[model samples]
Target: ILAGYYILGFSIYSSILLAGLFASQTLIAYPIVNKLGIARDKAVTIAVGGTVITDTLALLLLTVIVGMATGNVDDTFWWRLGISVLVCILIIVVLFPIIAHWFFKLCSDNVSQYIFVLAMVFLGAFLAQLAGLEPIIGAFLSGLALNRLIPKTSPLMNRIEFVGNAIFIPFFLIGVGMLIDYRAFFRDWESLEVAAVMIALITVAKFIAAWLTQKSFRLSKDQRTVIFGLSSAHVAATLAAVMVGYNVILGHTPDGEPIRLLSESVLNGTILMILATCIVSTFATQRGAHNIAVKNALQTNDEEKSRPEEHILIPVANEQSVDELVGLSATIKRAKEPNGLYALHAIDNRVDDPNMEKRARKLLDGAAKTAAAGDLYLQQLLRYDVNIANAIVSTVRERNITDIVLGMHQRTPGSTALPAIPGIPGIPGTSGPGIGKMVTDVLSQSNVTTFIYSPAQPLSTIKRHLVIVPPGAEKEAGFQMWLQRIRQLARNTGAKVAFFASDATLQHIRPRRERKAPANIGFVPFDRWDDLPSLEHDLRDDDCLWFVMSRRDRVSYHPAMSRIPGYLEQVFAGYSAVLVYPVQAGATDRYL
Candidate 1:
C-alpha cells in the first residue's frame, strides 16, 4: 500500500501513513461469520491471525518512519524500539494469559470476571504506552491472551460482546464519524479523486492478498471472499494513524505555508475509504458465508450415508420461552451431530430502541445456556428487520435450516377456551394471531419441516407420542421427512409412537416402520379423517399429541382437521402437543 501510494506521487511520510492505515483493518465481519457458523473455521482463524501479523508489521514500520522523520532515529531509538516491542510481546503473550487463566479459575462471579477483563485491557494499553508503542496493540494482544479463558458460548462471552458491540463500539464509531470533514469533499472536490484512488488501491491490494492466501492455503472461493471482506474494513487503527499524521507538519510549502502531510482532503478521503470498504466488506462476507454454508451442507449430505445430520433452527421471541424452545431442540436433535441446534432471535427493527439488540443477545444467551445444560451446542443467530418472517426465511435458506421449532403464541392457553373461528386454510386456531401469522408465512414460504411445539408440561416426562395423520398426509412430500424427525424424537425419548391414520396411510408407512422402527411405532386405523375429535378421549397426561398436517396449497391438506389446535386446547389441554408442518415444496432436506 505504501509503495502504491508513493508511486502515485504521495510524499514518503504520507505514503507510509496510508500504508499503516490500510494495513490495520477492523474485524467488522466477525459478527456475521459468528452467526454463519464459520467463526471457528480454519480460514477465519487464519484471516484473524493474519490481521495481527500485518498490523504489527505496519505499526512497526510507522514507528520507524516517524522516528526518522522526527530526527530521532539514533542507535538509542533502535535499542528502545526493539526492546520495547519484545518486552510488550513477552508481557502480553506470556504473562497476561497465565494471570488471566489463574484469575478466571479463581473468580466464580461473572461480574467480577467482566470487570477483570476490562482492567486487563486497560492494563495492556498502559503497558504498551510505557513500552513506547500504541495502546491499541496492547489491547489487541490482551484480547488474544484472554481469548481461551472466555468460551464463545459462555455467558461471560455474551456479556462482553453485548457491552462492547452495543455500547462502546457504537460510541467509538460515532466519534470516528464526527471526525470526518464532510465539507472537505465539497470545498475541495479533488478529495473525491483521492478517495477513489485510495479505495481502489486498498480494495485491490486486499483482494490480491486474500486470493494469494486462498491459493496458498487451499481455501475455497467463499472462504477467500470472507477473508477479503473481514480484512478490508479500515476503522480504529486507520483513523488513529491518519489523525496522528494530520497533526504532523512534514515541512513548509514553496510559498512558506505550513504543509500538513495529511490534509483535510486526505483525511476526508480516508473516511470515505473506511465507509466504502465497510459496506463492501459486510455484504461480501454475508454473501460468501451463505455460499460456503450451502456448499458445506451439500458436501455433508453426500458424506452422511450412515446417520443424517439434522440442523434444527429454533426461532425464539419470548425470553421466558427460550429454555423450552432450546431444550426441546436439544432433546430432539441428533446426539451424534456436532453443533446441531441453531437459536435465532429476530429483533423487530420498527421498535426503535437502541438496547433491543442487547436485550436480544441476553435472550439468546439464555437459550444457549439452556442448550449447554443439556450438553448441546447452540449456534446463536441475531437479526434486525421489520419483517421477521422474511428475515427468518432468508436465514433458513442461507444457513440451510432443515427443521424449524417454534413456540406457541402467548394467547394460546387462554384462547383455547374461545370457540374456534375459521383461521388460515391449514392452521388450527384463529386465537394465536402472532404465532399463526409467523407459522403461516414460514411454512408456506420456506422449504423445511416445522414443528410448532406447545409445551403443556415437561417434555421429558411424556412417554407416548400420539400422531394424528390428516387423510392424504402420507402422500405429501414432507410426510417421510416429519416421520423421520418424529422417529428420532421417539427413539431418543424411548417413547411409544401411536399413529392414527387411514388403512392406506398405515400401509404406506408399514414398510418404513418395519425397516426403521417396528418396535417403537404402532399404527391404528381411523377410517374417517374427521374422527380426530374422538381421539381426545384416549389422550393421557403422558401423551404428546402430534398433528402431522400439510401445507395449505398441498394435495394432502384437510379442511376437517383445521380444528386440530382447538381440539388440543379444548379437550387435550392437559397434555403437551406438537403441530407438524411438512417441509415446503422444493426445500432442501439435508439440514433438517
Candidate 2:
C-alpha cells in the first residue's frame, strides 16, 4: 500500500514540477544571462542550451514510466543505460566538435547555421538513445559544440529563438498546468511532507553548488551573491531531469506500478522546489544587479544639457545648384543670429541605372563643401530602396528637425494628366510637390514648421512687403514670433509692411448693439473689396503683400471668391501677395 502511494504521488509531483521547471527556465535565464554582461545573442544561446536538456530528460522519464507499468525493470537495462551515457559523452566531446567545424565552413548564411545546429542536436540525441544513454547529455554536448561554431550575432539564431519563446515555450507551460491535480496535495499529509523535504534538499544542494563554484573562482562578494542567488533557481532542466529519471531510468512493475515506488512523491517535491527557487532567485538577483548598475550609471553623468531652439531641416538634392543652394545658404546667413539650419540629402536607390551612385556622390560632395565653407552643420543620409516620403519623415523625427525645405525642382506641383501640346518640355517626371505634401502632413500630426521655396525666385533680401490677414479670433501666442522674424527680415532689407482685414462682408450681417475692436492692433474694416479705393493706391506703393494665414473658425471662401482666375491675376487686380502661414514656434506639424 505504501509503495503504491509513493509511486502515485511521485508521478503526479514529477508532472507538475517538470512543467514548472521549463517555464521558469526561460524566465530566470533571460535576466541572469543579461546580468552577466553578455550580449543579447550570447545570452539567448546560453538559455537555449540550458532548456535543451529538459526535453531529453522528459523523454527519458516517460520511458522509465512505461517500463514500470509493464514490470520490465532489469539489470541489463541499467548496464545498457550506463553504456549509452558513456557513448554519448565520447561522441559529444570528441566527434561533435570535428563535425561542427566542418559544417560551419560549408555555409555562410544565417538559415544554414540554424539547420546545422538543429541537425547536430538530433544526431546527438539519436546516438545517445542507440547507446542506451540519457539523450539530454547528448543534447547539451551538441549545444556546447555548436556554440563554438556559431557566431553570437547570427540573424538565424535570433529568428529561431524569438519564434520558440513567442510560441512553443508558453504553450508547453500552460499545457503542463492543465495536467496538474491540485486536490492531491491537500488529501495526503505524509506525501506533502515528503515533497517539502525534497524541495528543501534541492534548494540547499543548489545553493551549495553555487557557493562552491564562486569560491573556487575567487569571485568578489557581490558577484558570488548574485551567482548563488541566480543559480538556486531550478527551471526546466531540473524538472525535466527528474521526470526522465522516474519514467525511463526506472520502469514500472508487473502489477502496472511505476518501477520506482517513490516516483510521484519525488516529482511533487521537485515541483515545489522549482517554484520556490525560481521566484526567490529571479527577484533577488535582478533587483540587486539592477540597483548596482543604476547607481554606477548615475555617478558617471558628465554631458551638458542642450538649449531648446527651433530647428529647420532642409533636404537638398544638389548643393551645387547655385540658384537654390546658394540662395538658401545666403538666406540662413543673413537671418538673425542663433538660428538653426540642417541641410539633408537622401541617396535614393530606386533607379536601376548604374550612374545613380555617381550622381548621388557628386551631389553629396557639393553639399559637404558648401556646409564646410559656411561653417554650418549638414546631415547626409543614404537610403537604399526605401519610400522617399517615409525616409524624409523618419529622418525628420530622428534628427528632431522642426522645419523642412526642399529644392524647388522637388517641390513643384505636377499636373494630374499630360498636356495635349507636343514637344513642350514635358513636366519633369520627377517634379512634384510631394515634399510639400509630406511637410503639410507632418505639420498636422506634429508642430513642425515648413518652408517651400521656388528655385527660380529665391529670396535674397527681406525688403519684401508684409501682409497680415487676421481671422478675427483671439490672437495666437505665436503671432509675436512670426512678427519678429518678419520685422527682422524687413530691418535687414529696407522693406515696407501693410496689414489688411476683411470688413466689406461684415455689414451684410445684422448689426449688433455694440462693436468691440481687437486690443493692441488697429484695423480699418470695409464693406467690400471695391469699397476700399485706397487698396489699389496702397498696392502701387508697396513692392509685395505678405499675407499671414492663421487657423480660425470663421475663414471660409465664398463662391464668388472660388472662381477668381489665378493667384497672379487676383494680385494684379490690386496688390502682389506673398502669403505667409503663421505656425507656433518650434511646433512640429505632420502635413502628410
lDDT of each: 0.75, 0.48
Instruction: Output candidate 2 Cα RMSD.
Output: 26.0
Best by TM-score: 1
What are the root-mean-square deviations of the candidates from the true structure over C-alphas? 18.0, 26.0
Off by over 4 Å in 1: 1-8, 251-257, 301-592
For candidate 1, the lDDT comes to: 0.75
Per-model TM-score, in order, reads: 0.53, 0.42
lDDT of 2 by residue, 1-592 (tens): 2222353344553444333333333235454545443212222333344345444554455445445444676878767766767767787878887776555444434466667777888888687767654465466568666553332222344455666779867886675465345676887765477656655654665567556755776644444445545555665556556655555434556787756533555566566666677677777566545654554446534311222355656665654352245334333232323235555555556667657666666666666554443334455555553545566677767777644555433323554532222222432221113223554444445444344443323232222353434443124434444444444443333234444555642322212322322122233453333232234555442244444443322233122221111222333333434333345533433433
Number of the top candidate by lDDT? 1
Per-residue CA lDDT of model 1 for 1-592, tens digit only, reads: 4553554567776777777777888888888987776665667888888888877777676677776776778879989989998998899999987787667645545688889899999999889878877788889889987775554434566688889989999999898899886777778566898888889988998999999999998988999999998999988777767776777786797899878767777788888898999999999889888888777778767545644457889988887677667756765665445486888888887788878888888988988877765556789999887777887888888887878999875454544434445543333454335346777677656777788989865554455788888777776777777876766665455567898888878888676435444466788887666556677677765688888876555767776555666666565667788888886454433323
Candidate 1 residue 269 Cα shift, in angstroms, is: 0.9
